[model samples]
Each structure stands twice: as C-alpha cells, then as structure tokens.
Target: MGDQIELNRRYIPRLPSQTQTQSKRKGAGARTWLVVSKLGQVSVEELGKQTVMRRTGITAHDLRVVEPELSYPAAVLRRERAVVVNLEHVKAIVTAEEVLVPNPRDPRIASFVYDLEFKLSADFSATMTREKAMEQLPTDTPPEASGSRREAKMRYSKPLPFEFRALEICLQSVCKSLESETSTLEEEAYPTLDQLSAKTSTNNLKRVRVIKGRLVSLTGRVQKVRNEFEHILDDDMDMAQMYLTDKLATLQHEGVSEDEMDDDADVILLGTDINENMSSKCSTLFASDLKPNVEELEMLVGSYFVEIEGILNKLSTEYVHDTEDYINIVLDDKQNQLLRMGLVISTASFMITVAIVAIGFLSINIRIPLFDFGTYTQWYEAFGGCVVCSVFLYIMAVLVFKFLGLLG
Candidate 1:
C-alpha cells in the first residue's frame, strides 16, 4: 500500500512536469512587441524588454535618453540616413500658427500625418490617429493626444496631409537631434569626404546646415526629395523668420537653465551682448530683422556667380578677337612700308651704277684736266655708304615703333 502511495505521489496531478514547467517559464519571459507604422505600413518593431528597435532585417542599439525626467523612455536615435527621437524627452511643445498665416510670420506651409500607439504593461495598447495627431493643444494635455507635438512643431506651422507631413516632421526632428548630438562629440561619427566620394550612385551633394553662433556647417545631404517640395514665397519667408524667433526664445530658456546650473551669469550676459551686436549688424546689412530663406539665398548667390562668369567669358572672347584683327592690320602696314623701302633702295642702287658707268665713259672719251680715278672712286664709295646708313636707320626706327606697340 506504501509503495502504491509512493507511485501516486510521483504522478501527482497538482504539480506539472519539469519540461512543462520549464517551457511555461520561458514563455512568461518572452518579450512583447510594439508595432510602429508610418502611413499604415510597418516601419519598425519596438521590443519592450530590450527597448531597442528592430528594422530592415537588423537590430540597432537602444536610443540614448537625453532627459530622464519624463515618464517614458524618451531617446534620440542617430542613424545613417535619419534621426529618430521620442517626443517625451522634450521639455515643452509650442505651436505658433500665427507664423504660418499670410499677414504674419510666413512659415513653410506643410501637411503632416502621424499614428502612434502606446502599449502599457497589461497588454493594453491605445493608438492616436492621424486626425488627433494634427490637433495643437496646451502643454498640460494627456500624453495619448499630444502625438509628437515637440517634433512636429519644429518642422511645420500648419496642418499637413496625412503621412506626408508626418514623415517630413520626423525627418526634420531626426536631423535636429543629429545636429545637437554631433556638436558634442569629439570625433566625427558621420561619413567623411573620402568615403562619400568613393560610393557609387551616392547623392553626395546634399547637406545639413548646423548653425552655431554666426557659423554654419553642412553636415548631411540636403535630400533631393525634400527639394522637390520646397517652394518659398513671401509667406514662407515670414514663416522662416517666425521660426527663427521661436528658436531663439527656446534657446534663451534652455540657456538660462544651463546658466543657472553653472552658477555663472556670464554666459547669459555674453549671449545678450552677442544678440545685441548681431541685431545691430543685421540692421546695418539687411535693414530688417526678418530673416531670409537660406536655401533661396544660396540659390541667388549661385545664380549671380553664373551670370557674372558668362558676362566675363563674352567680354574676354570679344577682346581677343578684336586684338587679333588689330594685329593683322598692323602687320599689313609693316609689310607695305618694307616694300616701299625696298623699291627706294633698288632705284638708288640703279642710279649709282649709272653714275659709275658714266664717270668711266667720260674718262675714256675725254681727258679732263682735274679728273682722277682715285678721287672719283672715293666719292662714289662715300655716296654708296650714305645710302646704306639711311636704309639701316629707317629699319631700326620701324623696329622701335613696333616694340612700343605703336604699330598695332
């Protein structure tokens, strides 16, 4: 009976098998997945346990968190083609629609779409639709409705079309994060000219402009796709100015915090001084604080250089052709002068020969009382020497005039 009891104990129904227990434990530890989609297409899968992104058949590192004060794991992802950042890390999200309107600050008019899902610990997930994402709200609103306003505000001022504006805003956020992070790194984390030049079919001409004080550096390719969409008008120009004003305000706020942390008011004071100086300079140069579109400004400068080059080429060609014609005319005049001189020399030589022959004939035909061979020969030689010297002097004068550029 005891043996039977032992067997029954071993086969108890209350306890599971070792294998079954192990399988259950493994299943419990399995990580949850969050689907991140753009325009109804899955772009990335976020692993809950690892807090890492899995995309394009590859797994990347966890994004770096800048501000840990937020409730979520807000981070900045710096990738090869784009930057990805969670909006939760942002201190504040401000939307200035006044900058977008026609009469005020003309911001780049764009349409945007966004769809974000929040997955909680209890397998409960809620999604914010594109329509909800487009609405601008006060800072105290619930997280479920905000929909990346911090990132969206940076790129656009007005409502955009679904999916299109979302992608652009995301891209712009990524670029801003990259610029901010790279400014702190000691070594270059991006591609160099050598690497960029060697790649095939690489769009190397594109660049990202990083503004620090008065200096700007182009760090990434200005996407050709974005260029196709950028059309600036007076409204856009006004919007750009407003954007700059908004950025300055944000910078001042952040800078004040940093200054407080450092216990040094010098940074803020210097910043103010610089601002005053810049304002004065801008007024002197541009006559207004309204900023121009940088891309349009660059295009204008490039067009000016091209036009100047064309004008210079035309002028150079005309000058060269006219110079050649003038040279040809001068050369013809020199040739005529040489021909005239030769004709005079030939006539003088003929006359001297005749004179010599006549003198000889007169000596043979009639004996003159005072005439002698030696004296007559001497006079003939002297006259011949004078004619030769005169010809040499005339040739030298022509050469001098030619050297002085008087002939041409």
Candidate 2:
C-alpha cells in the first residue's frame, strides 16, 4: 500500500506555509518546492502519517481516483513522503473509468465523462503568485488581516527540501503510473487488432477515436506544461514573482508608509521635513528590488513532461496503426463477401441460359401433334410454346434457388 501510494497516489495538500512569509510556517506550504540544477529542476515533498494529504480547495489527482468507483483499500505510507518537485505546467483532467465496454482501440472507460478540467499552464509569475500569502487569503478575508487565512488552514506537513535524488524518486513514481496505464491499454485494446471482425467496424472506429482523442489531448497538455516552465525560465520578471513570500514579507516588515488603503495614493505630507524622495515609497519598489536569480527554485519539470508526452505519442501511433489494420481487415471481408455474391449471380444467369437452350430445341424443325408440319401456323404455335416454356423454367429455377437460400 505504501509503495502504491508513493508511485502515483500521493497528493500534497495546499498548505499555509506556501502562502506565508516563512516556509516554516505552521501550514500553507506549496504542494511542491523546486530546486534548480544544471541537469534539470527537482521537486521534493515529505509525506508522513500526520501529513495533510487530503483537503479541499485543491485538485486531487492520482491513479486510484482515475479508476472506477470500485472500492480500494485505504492507502497509507510510513515513510515521510518525499518527491522531487519542479514548476512545470503538466496537468490532465482526471480521466474517469467504469464497467466494461469493449472497444477495438481502448479499454472500457468511465461511464460518466467530465467535460471540464484545468490545464497546468500557469507561468512562473502565476505559479509563484499562487504560492503567495496574498493569494491564499480567502475572498472574504481582507488583505490587512491575511495572516488569519494561513492560520485557519494550517498543518504540520514537512517540506522535502530541494534534492535531485528525491526528485528522481518522485518522477519515477509518476512514470510508473503512466507505464502501468499504457500496459493495461496494450493488453485491453491492441492485442485484438488483427482479430477484429467486419460487423463491428464502425464501433471499433468509434472506440479508436475515443482513445486517440485522449492521447491527443494529453499531448497538448504536456506541451502546455513544458511551455509554462520555459516561459518563466526565460523571463527575469517572471522569476522574481516566484519570490512571492519574500516580497510580501518585505512589505509587511517595512510597514506601508504611504496610504495603506490605496497603493496608488499621491504623495501626502506626513511631516514638513519629508522630502519628495519619501513620497509614495511603495512605488519605488520594482522588479529590480526582487532578486530573480534565487537559487531556491529550478523549473526542471519539462524533461519528464516531454517524456510522458512521448509515451502518449507512442500510444497514439499504435492506436492509429491498429485502427487501420482493423479497417483493412473489415474491408477485405466485405470484398470477399461481394465476390461470393457475384459468383452466385453468375450461376443464376447460367441456369437461365440452360433453360433457354432447352426451350430453343422445341422451335427447331420437327414433327408436332395436331398441326400440319412446316406450316406457318404450326411454326407460330411452336415459337409461342417455346417462349412460354423458357420464361416458366427460368422463373421456377430462380424461385427454387432463392427458396433453398443459395442466391443470397
């Protein structure tokens, strides 16, 4: 259970430490904390029994939640949950699952499908902003008393310090989850590609579309995540915003000398000795004041983001090839059926031709009863009889073949 929980079932609660001036605050820690390296970014989080693993106000994502509503043993882990962290924007809506529905291209999915899900596309600034004390303040809470918001939802969870090895463990867990899912799909959908039948061609195609569509959606999601991290890494201002806790802390420690209510307030004289330089002191604070090169964070999540994307891409390719194979097999089957029907039709034509040949013999010059031989009237009577007999034999033979189920 612990192993399963760590691989992909782990979730970090939105903590108060993440939003406050101190990473050591009682609660409100960012679910992940980043450490940068030349190789890539690292994310680390510590999980323990007392850790705040579940809560509201943040999305829950993991494998069990993705599977159907069937019961699963409550997952618990004894080790402190530690996962390497980075600021990447890879988020996919939790895909749902349900009872069996055989699809040529995918395994059975959840009966109830959800339409809306958030993407992990937040830029560095937005990501940092989300981690800020100001952002964590509930809408009903005033900015002046923002500390109360952190206090209300505080927890005792520990932060996994930025470490490369720890990050690897976290990433491996995610990879494991993805690998398991891909393997399941291979077993459920890809194996029978060659065995698909003509009767279910349309259904197979529909199922294939569902699977391919999911992969395509995942590709876009992974790309967006990679792009988000890159955007922050390239921009200094974006990086500075990630120091949200520090900036807010600085403002609080300095105390708003200007009108605290309106940051846009014009310079007002608190004392005659005050010079123009002192006016609107808060405005003097700029992105330059916030250091962008904080070694505390590294956005190295793109590597794994792309890796997962590659997996999804590979799955999509397999599905495409399988769909084509199934379709080709179905078409071949239809063609064979058509060929057999053509042979049946030719056989019917031959039977009619034989009947015509047998009737033609009666029209040839020969003696006949109750008529003068070689007279025009006798010849006309023979010709009429020949036509009647030929028509009757052809119709009878067709009816007999149809009745015997041979002409279908």
lDDT of 2 by residue, 119-217 (tens): 111122343444464445567867877776666546322222223223333344445555566666666556445334434556666776676565565
**Predicted candidate 1: what Cα RMSD to the true structure?**
26.4
Q: What's the lDDT for residue 201 in model 1?
A: 24
After superposing candidate 1, which stretches have Cα over 4 Å from the reference?
1-294, 323-327, 343-347, 350-354, 357-365, 368-408
Clashes (N, CA, C under 3 Å) per candidate: 15, 27
lDDT of candidate 1 over 287-351, digit per residue (tens): 34355544533343234334333333432334334533654566677687787677556655665
Cα misplacement distance, residue 242 of candidate 2 (Å): 2.3
lDDT for 7 in candidate 2 is: 22
TM-score of 1: 0.22
lDDT of each: 0.33, 0.39
Among the numbered candidates, top lDDT falls to: 2
The alpha-carbon deviation from the true structure for residue 36 of candidate 1, after best TM-score superposition, in angstroms, is 50
